[model samples]
Target: MEWQVWLSIAGITLSTFLARSTLLVAGSRLRLPPRVESALRFAPACALAAIVLPDLAYVQGVLQFDLHNARLLAGVVATVFFALTRSMTGTIGLGMCAYWALRYLAGP
Candidate 1:
């Protein structure tokens, strides 16, 4: 790799470290508003959905939302399972089982 690429990587690493650590280091002194804190509580779920939704919704570079899409169907099943049981472990297990079963049933 070129020296410029190495330097850029080092800079990015340092900046990311500082950005993340600053919050923890100054957390005791920082006071967020109640509304902001409440909103921040949902950030994890929002981030997760942003990352996972696209993968479940898209297949072969196309958007799919029908019964033919195994991932989408598995996600729906997992969602319902989670909603009914409130168990993260069960949700993941059932989701993977559903996905595998759907894929196997679809055949090649």
Candidate 2:
């Protein structure tokens, strides 16, 4: 509704597009050193843990821990499965299935 708001939105959209384009162009053309390539391989694992760990530890806007918390148990099982199988798809599918089953079984 306001000119300032429209300008701010345009600025944000332009900045976001530029930032992503820069990364894509640089990442494709530039040859990363071996050390950098090795470190980049761990980025996905670290990012996944950073996102999942907090959810497993919290629920419904409150901190909780008990047998009823299925996410925590499922995460442990998933971690073990990942260690043993080393299959990303299998680990994720098993973890999701385990979480759903536990949640259903633990229903109030």
Reference-based TM-score, model 1 = 0.71
| lDDT per model vs. reference | 0.96, 0.90
lDDT of 2 by residue, 1-108 (tens): 599999999999999989778778777777889999899989999989899888898988677777778988898989999999999999999999999999889876
Return the number of clashes found in candidate 2.
Answer: 0
Global CA lDDT of candidate 1, please?
Answer: 0.96
Residue-level lDDT of model 1, residues 10-92, one tens digit each, is 99999998988989988779998999989998999999999999999999889998999999999999999999999999999
Backbone clashes per model, in order? Answer: 0, 0
User: Per-candidate TM vs. native?
Assistant: 0.71, 0.59
Candidate 1: 10-residue stretch with minimal lDDT? 19-28
Which candidate ranks first by TM-score, i.e. highest?
Answer: 1
- Model 2 whole-model lDDT (C-alpha atoms): 0.90
Q: What TM-score does candidate 2 reach?
A: 0.59
Error of 2 at 95 (Å): 0.8
